[model samples]
Target: MKFTDGYWLMRPGFTARYATEVADVRAEADRMTLYAPVKHVVSRGGTLNSPLLTVECWSPAEGVIGVRTTHHAGSVRRGPEFALPGAEQGAGVGKVRRDGEVVELVAGDLALRVDTAQPWKLEFTAGGQVLTSVGERGTGFVTDPAGRHHMLGQLGLGVGELVYGLGERFTPFIRNGQVVDIWQADGGTTSEQAYKNIPFHLTNRGYGVFVNHPGKVSYEVGSESVGQVQFSVEDQTLEYFVVYGPTPKEILRRYTALTGRPALPPAWALGLWLTTSFTTDYDEATVNRFVGGMADRGIPLSVFHFDCFWMRGYQWSDFCWDGETFPDPEGMLARLKEQGLKICLWINPYIAQKSALFEEGRQAGYLVRRPDGSVWQWDLWQPGMALVDFTNPAATAWYIDKLRQLLGQGVDCFKTDFGERIPTEVVWHDGSDPERMHNYYTHLYNRAVFELLEQERGEGEAMLFARSATAGGQQYPVHWGGDCESHFNAMAESLRGGLSLGLSGFGFWSHDIGGFEGTPTPAVFKRWVQFGLLSSHSRLHGSKSYRVPWDYGEEAVEVTREFTLLKHRLAPYLQRAAQQAHATGIPVMRAMVLEFPEDPAAATLDRQYLLGEDLLVAPVFTDDGTVEYYVPEGTWTNLLTGAQLTGPRWIREQHGFHTLPLLARPDSVIPLGADDQHPVSAWADGVELRVHAFADGAERTVEIPRSDGPGRTAAFHLRREGGVVRVTTDSPHAWQLRIGGPDGVLHSYPAGTSEAELRYES
Candidate 1:
């Protein structure tokens, strides 16, 4: 996508034109139109050649500005636009101020300035400080060899400006010096390609730019020019939105308000999930053994996922249980559910020729077709597989009927997989352009199943362990990191992908605990156990192998049990965090930069992340069980070891299999459930409000939402003055209180108590 040869020359057979001056301007209520010819018209004789580039600017919602530049206004635009929230443009209202040859449109806290005189420029400012600007030669109309017409825009990159969130990238957490293409692909965890490529990026400078195109967007982040973040899109118009954060959290809030926030997944979906891994020989006996083994070890396994083998081989996505492997699926699912487990079966939007549904789909015109009106079939992962044409309503209904049968068999969730393998050289049912539908197919594919789940099971009960997503796919609940190798490097790569996805507005994300491509070593398995249990969603899945903890070693099972129980205890806090995400569009598992935007040290720290704003989880990525992590300015308390440490510094330590560095920030109140029997939907019987180190006037609120009804909620303050400490809460729920850091317990309050007001004086 790069056409510039070094800094000054253009590549052969390619030429781009830039506007040097705006010749005329027209102003409306909330929008401004500028007609800028490629060259300045010095006189009436000079206005004789080339097309005028039409650039229009406006504000959509508060703190957001949109700019659309076009070389040809007659170009046709197809369907399948992003599913943005219906907010009126300039909902917060804005004003136009004209001064000399400069016109400015100022929205709430954000202003877009345009110059009609010499050196045409477009600048975006927040609160009077310029964030980024489109300086000289920043806009170009490109003409390349293939006759492709593209509009490119370049924004100034300030010193130390690091960009993040082009969607689940595994290359590097800081997206500088990288050429990122916003196109969804089936590429795994090791490649520069991503499964979910959102065309939005947030910088450490408190601003974000979202390319308003569903098609592929080419981004050269400090790569092409080395001084600007340049983005280009094919066609006549380049439309983008500049959203002002003023802070990262507010940036996400406004962004998701424009797009959508994740629906709160069901409580059961938040707990530990054990899967019968892909290509593993699993029948009724094997599933029972794995499920029973976890129970025998007192491990709370919430969801049991049956991978691809659930359907007969070569007949992928038949939506029927393999008769040979699972003869009695109904009775089998009932028995597993009797053991307090939810069922999730893997399904994709493909119908193999060998499948029983293939003939039906092909005959009913429910599959994608070629130009010759023949079903577009491929033999990549499945033999002669044809994609389900979700663009057709009847085809979607036919697919839904097949899934409804699985729900009848007690499948509580669906692992909507393989939407990334969608082909672009085909004809869609609704006549949607194949190129545009390539990435947006996942949204439709998952939406069909997610809506069906909501129809069957009531609202707030639908959950999907989806693998592929694009922009606005956050409306679906949970997505996991796709295939990864079984190693420390792959573990870190998965975390980077999840953190990047979180920055892209996804609320819940997970990954395979012990990796997905192969079996993990015992040390790696146990370490990933702690890390997985800390994610927003936890699951044990892999390819060509089983992910049971016992398969690694007894130590793996012990570590799994310990962390699973700890996660179960942390469910109250986790669920509240999820609710906050649903409300505010912030992620449950956030990157440190999201919580600590002021700390430049946190902008690149991908190995460690903050789990729900209070606890810092640094997963050990070495065989020696040592980790190096950064803590922002604070008096932090280690949650696992009860040791208090002062930071704004880096700490490196080695540990054993049972422990990782789990720390709690100062002045935080962490809630723990009393029992680990049922990790989902169970009310806290004897809740323990673990209060960490605090200063006077520091208060914390804990809100626990229940499935059956409104759950118990509490807020308390911690104050230490004149050699005395006091704690207070207005909660009516019965709970105990514990005071201390990780080093040792200060005191434990009696159970069945609602409030504990104690004074400590020396």
Candidate 2:
């Protein structure tokens, strides 16, 4: 990906060309086209010999500009395009000035300057201040030794600036000085993420550069030149979008509007999800005991997940329950459903030789094949496993039909796993380049299953416990970090990955509550239980061991019960955050930097996160329960103990079993549901609105969406104005309010309680 030898020389065997001068410019209603020659045409005869690069610029949505530069216009673009959001382009209103050896094109707040002479430079400015620059020989066309052509672009890096978010990277928190290839692979948490994305990074300087490509995008971030971020892909055309933020939140707002925000998952999906351990012994009795044991221990379980053992060994994704273990799956699910629990089973896109449908897929050309016309096989996860070619329409339908059968037999949702182990040596039915299909395959695989879920289940009810993802995978509801060791360090790494993924434009993310690998000790499991229940989606899964709380100890059971109920009680606030994630691109679980950009401590604190912009959750990673956390300049009150602390300083303290560093930001009105007996929906019926640290004149609105349907039907927003806090309702249903602070009891009305009074204790 990096072709530069150093700061001064280009690497051998590579030719770089850049637009030196804008020969002419044409402006339309919402677009601008520039004809720039790589070399200045001294005469009319010179223009005929050199290639004129065509750079077309336009706005996809407000505050986001797209630039498509083409060296050759007639290249064939294959399938596998990113499904970006549709937008209405606004009219342009800037001036274009051209002078000898210099040309400047200005549109609204964006300005681009092109140098006409040697070492061509394209500088982008906002309000007359240089933001980033494209330097000499920075943009060019590349053809690999295999005859694959590609367009490359490099932009100048600024001092002290950092890059973040290329989709679920497991590398360092900051993405600088790294050569990242955007390809989805089954490389675990230890490697540079194979599940890479083209969505570029938003810098600390308040601007983002996103590559508009679904195929493989290789990024050399400060690794090649140490002063430039170079990105390249296989094609003659390069398309990218420059989204202006001026703030990280604004950048995500503009970015998600261009790509699509995630859908808010169902209320039940937020509760604790318990799974029978993968590759462990689990039958009808084991499932019942796990469900019954949680109830016996007062741990409110919502969803029970069956791992790969649900199907016969070596025949995953057959959609048939293992008859030896689960004699009657339909009846078992019916009984579990009678106990008011949801069901999830493991599945993947791989078709094993032992699977019944392998022959069907092989005969129908639904399976991926190598160049020699033989079915590509791998024994990595499963023996003789072949990948389902999701690019083919009939192949997708065939796979969906099997899943539909499982749905009819009582499976609620599927944990779509292992799409990252895609083969790059095979050919897709749609003729997509194999290397490009590596990452793009996940998008198609998840899309097929997600679309099917939406069809079978209702709109808001569809959710996938997905593992792998690419660009635009945020449309799917929940994705969990793949596999991790059952240790405190892995717990922290999982958090780092989630925070990183959230920065990558993903909304809802989950992980194995007690880690996925070996069996966790009581201390680790208890600590992980608290952290897991607080996540957007909580699941207790592991390898070779049961994740049931009592398996560790009674204390672990107690911790699990406390946090699970606490999460159910906090559903009102979490769902609102989820709705915001659906509306904007902001993640439900956001990094501190996303919420507090001005706070230097927030930029480096991956161990802690601002949960839904209100609560700060620093999961205890050590057995000692000592936590070191930072709060932005404000008064933060602990949500559990009501202990208030002043921020802009680091606080280190040891916590108990019932407490962690969960603090609510100043002026935050955190809404809590009343009940934790069932899932979130039942609790949201009568919610208790808890107003925390209501700073005078600092208006804050808490919207609790209706649980039944869409469109934000039933909700309440509290606004503090002129020393009075007003709680207004959007739902016509009657509601009651509670005030807990220095104030005693607020006046409560019927379904629509628009006003309240708190007795201020001064």
When superposed on Cα atoms, how far off is each prediction in RMSD?
1.8, 2.8
Summarize candidate 1's per-residue lDDT along 533-650 as a digit string, tens digits: 9999999998988899888988888898889889888888899898888889999989999999988888899999999989999999999988899988878888887877788999
How high is the CA lDDT of each candidate model? 0.86, 0.80
Q: Give candidate 1's error at residue 421 in angstroms.
A: 2.3
Task: State the TM-score for model 1.
Answer: 0.97
Q: How many pairs of residues collide in model 2?
A: 6
Candidate with the greatest TM-score versus the true structure: 1
* Global Cα lDDT for candidate 1: 0.86
> C-alpha displacement of 508 in model 1, angstroms?
0.9
